[model samples]
Target: MTIKELETRTGMTRANIRFYENEGLIAPSRLPNGYRDYSERDVHKLLKIKLLRRLQISLSDIKAIVRGNRLLDEVLEVQLQTLQQAQEDMSLAASVCETMLADHVAFSELNAMQYLMTIETGARERRSDYFEVKGDELPQVHQPWRRFFARFFDMMLYSSLWSASMMLFFNQNPSLQSDASSIIEGFIVLMIMLFVEPVWLHFFGTTPGKALLGLKVESDDGGRLTYGQGVARTWGIIGKGLGYNIPFYNLYRIWKSYRMCSDLETLPWDEDIAYTLKDSKKYRYVTYIGGIALLIFMLYTATAMKLLPPNRGDLTVADFAENYNYYLKYFQMDSDQYYLDDNGQWAEQEQNGSTVYLGIGFSERPVFTYEVVNGTLVAVGFETHIVGEERWVGSNDQYMVLSGLAFANGQKTVGLYSKLSQELVNAIDSHTFESFEFSQDGIQMRADVTYAGYNDFDSGVLIPMDGASSFTYDLLYEIRSNNE
Candidate 1:
């Protein structure tokens, strides 16, 4: 009720409580006599303020937390990180002090090089609490999938060895395989089985997975991993993996996910060794999505799109190595454009609300040949040679294969069968044709040879008639319905 009583309740002096009160971290009311009246809420706020101040949190952050302008966890998270960095610096300084003491060196006798040498040695020996001596170029973090696969490979080997040993020793009895209460067993296993990890790390500077993937776990100074450092690294990795062993089921999963999501490139647990993957490629772009999608893109582009029958068909040599080799290529359509993402997946760029996306069959290649239209891809007439000789596309009638994806009300419509009627197909193909005129009724195909020097006489169907020039409109119901 009073400042004295409030101070007794909060274990803080009246001056500190009043200072917090003035800072608005805690608010108090006045009684009828004009004396300060403290409530239970005020006592609680004062206690929190004292605790936050003791934690070395600035009053500004504490005030924000108290006023609900900031979350306590967010402020505390940033503060904790600052404190952690300070602790690391303190640890390094303490290590340097110990090194000097052990070597019987005095501060007055210390020169720049000798002092610098002490820190360098400290970095190698006590790398867990340090970094930064390695200089400006931080190595790239290994892609997530690389680290995932490496662990997967090593675990597979571990599982195979463990299973084989069990079968050999226990006569393949299923009952002896796993205990009903395996959670406790797993906890014990985590604690006991990984002792040999340090041995492998010491000898090979990596586990089997790291070695197989062309990864090394060496110090920044390029020295072999010390036995103590090996043991620390082993424990760090094991700690990340032990989330499932915590006895409580759901809590264990949450912890496991958090640990696994930690940045793998830096290996926050073990700074003693830097992870290096693929000497040929300094950085690897590994997608968490399936490789099958990319593999399908590659093989389908090569065989189903352009290569099987060996037709250039308006498909350029540049278009078909495809992006499946994991190179991104930009394509601008006349009105709409699309590109392959870094993973070689087709991505459409919205073109002012009128974008066309090609729809190939689940196992099919792109239907229409693509040519650069205003720096983007648009449908182009396909070129082919019959009898192993280059055939005039004007003379040949098979050029209709060049028709591909079209824009239908900002949606993708494939010109495969029923959608391939002259009227519907011209809605899209007309945009790319050198010359085209069509209204709500009769359609006109007018062109003086497409950029590749091929003339179309039968509308946008691209069915060429040799020596036939000028415009021809296809009003045949049979051709339209046959497409259906």
Candidate 2:
């Protein structure tokens, strides 16, 4: 059947059917004539969409309700509760209105009735039946620590095996540098360490860690965790382990926290829908719709790219800078200002008589700042931040990328400084170094050491490095500094 037939059968207009098609409520293939060919599935979907529309559900909300993974019984219970609530609200409103009109109605009582009506109208309509576990649902019956350790052993064993394999493979390919290979190896290991356990549990119901400790992650209501819930939990675990726990990446968590707080302050009462089990089908439908939409989009993109003129792989930074707004929006980067405040212009904000000026970089994740202390080099601070910049290939086309150092007492002069690695000890070429870099990786100082401090080797206190390593601990340096 064509879309017309579907419309006729469903008593929906052709435009409405087409609108549903565009919304991904139903997917119909194109016929040879370039017209939509609707199937039985399309008819059924239209019926469902119509029913859901009558219930005053948004498309996205309908999608979630239809695509949910909750059990059938759970879904029915949630639906029953929602209907009951709606009935009670309607009854309450009717009772209040009758009381106001029939008996003595005070001005204050009218305001209360209006407020109650507003709440009843604005209350969350929960169509999806699924609840996140509370803290008490911690499932402490199984020793989490023991399970973690046992899983750690398994992870270690696999890690060693993978490491050995990598070594052998890279050894055969002598061209691969230790630095590059290590980065790649580290990434792969991190991926495995992060996802392998959760994936294993997702597939086999228990990871080696959980199995060894005789632990199982069950739903709070004693049901198996829905696939979506399991995946969400897995992602949560992955974020905590990789994004928050690592050194440089740990700053991301702080940034996230700040952003979350800011958002709460700005829009504390943003719209939200509570989902219960009955909405599982809606959720499932939405998942299917999303998948179908994505697949169609991918196909369209591939086809369009193939048919159209190939995108110019060449565009210089200067060229992109002409359309800075376009580039900024595309990459979601914010414009950052870099000032030359050499005469301690911004000294009022200096900490401990040390002034720092920060310049936002191309990579928004890292804020680059040079710290000047008491007419000498102090540190360069790279506060790991997320500016939502897109990673581009080749040299930065629009901006000059430089790590500049300026002296506090001397004439307003700024010079470029080479980035120092965490492990590199000796200076590659002798240049008048001024500042140190402070990032999550490590703290690096200038080549020429100025300050002296005692080194307490054993204690975790701040030890003044006299001559411990090539790069002194006091040396302030940052990686990937950008030119304004």
Candidate 3:
């Protein structure tokens, strides 16, 4: 008979049946397809086991009787004596309860000591073979929340570090802003945690998060886990507890693990390993919160730094392009901004017609000129012209144009001349002019603003032309060596 048929015949749940099978109580043969084939004899054996269990016989005694290690009558005789003694104890307890009720004793007024003495005396005289219930089979200690938060803290720390590394070293933004990127980053962090967690467990018996939360993972012998054991336990946690952090399924696995933990069942990862937690204190929690805040701050600061170009020292043309792109992306100003081509030439997005700069439309591309001293870009300049036919310059348009120039020029404080001298911007800020020149600490900045007629495309210079209405701004910045 199949196991289902066996269930029907024996009226036992699949769990119970499987449990009994695991306990070696019954061995059903497997058919060709590897499904259990229960015999009629197996059903009889299950029924007998069920009857014996109802009689309050322990599984060990039943097994002994079934395996011919002990006679059924002998086990029954022992069970009978044990039950009669239990009955007498219960009868004595009932008599005591009746006496207390007859006395109309209030619980608060009742003498617990007196009742305990009477019960003890009665047990000593009547039940000579009685033994005290010490409750040695109590459930193991489990702190599911502490364990969870420790791992959470560790993962957050790892994520922050990984984000900082990616931004600082690779110039790649590791953001969790999108679902796909978040999942990929999360999986990578999980893998990193798995690899590093075992090392901590094996050497120190705890990780930073675990230590903060007063949790430790140890071997069965109450020592730090061996590396191999730690690896196995970590893998168990990743697979069974976290479900490999897969979408949707990870939640299910976490829920299942939580339920098991709440029920005081040993988690699979902790089968042979011991996970100990100390008594929690208020200060630890406060410190943990502060640490989390610090980590978040670190992540934000790294991301901000990544968004800014190298803010100090002489830069290459590529570095200048990076700063340009950073500004473009930061303000979301222009989609057709500049970039360094593969051949180290400056390039812009291909446009259909005219491009807008500082709210002014222009048909010609902006020109970039640079002076490199020994491969170090020492000076850079940008010039663009806006003709009158493109757009009429109202007061607002003129103000915007001037403000844009000031903003662009001020960026030198954080870019080209930033490392050269800090006082350059301070000096510039204290004065106001349509065009100004500032030289300090071997760094020189010159801004020449002029509104004129036409652009000299051939000569590559801004010169006065007849019958022309154009506005042009030229910004020339230079950094000189001490010897020069």
- Give the winner by lDDT: 3
TM-score of each: 0.28, 0.27, 0.47
* TM-score ranking from best candidate downward: 3, 1, 2
TM-score of candidate 1 relative to the true fold: 0.28
What is the alpha-carbon RMSD of candidate 2 to the true structure? 24.9
lDDT of 2 by residue, 300-417 (tens): 4333222211111222222222222222222323234222233212112243655465543433233335444343334333332212222221211112122211111111121112
- The global Cα lDDT (0 to 1) of model 3 is 0.67
Cα-based lDDT for every prediction:
0.49, 0.42, 0.67
Q: What is the Å distance of residue 83 in model 2 from its true position?
A: 1.0
User: Which candidate, 1 or 2, has the higher TM-score?
Assistant: 1
Ranking by lDDT: 3, 1, 2
User: What would the TM-score be for candidate 2 when compared with the true structure?
Assistant: 0.27
Q: List the residue pairs that clash in candidate 1.
A: 313-383, 332-375, 332-376, 333-376
Local accuracy of candidate 3 as per-residue lDDT tens digits, 1-484? 9888888999999998999999999999989999898999999999999999999999999989889999999999999998998888888889888888888878889888877777889899886444356434322447778778887898899888888887788666554246887888878988888788889998899998888877777887778898888889888988898888899899999999888989888888787877777768788898888888999988877865654454335556666555555544444445556544422244555566443333223333434556677876666554444445433322122112222222233343444323322254444443222356666445555555444553434332444566555544433223333322
Prediction 2 global C-alpha lDDT: 0.42
lDDT of 1 at 83: 88
lDDT tens per residue, model 1, 384-455: 222211223232121221222111111122212222234544543544334343322122222233333244
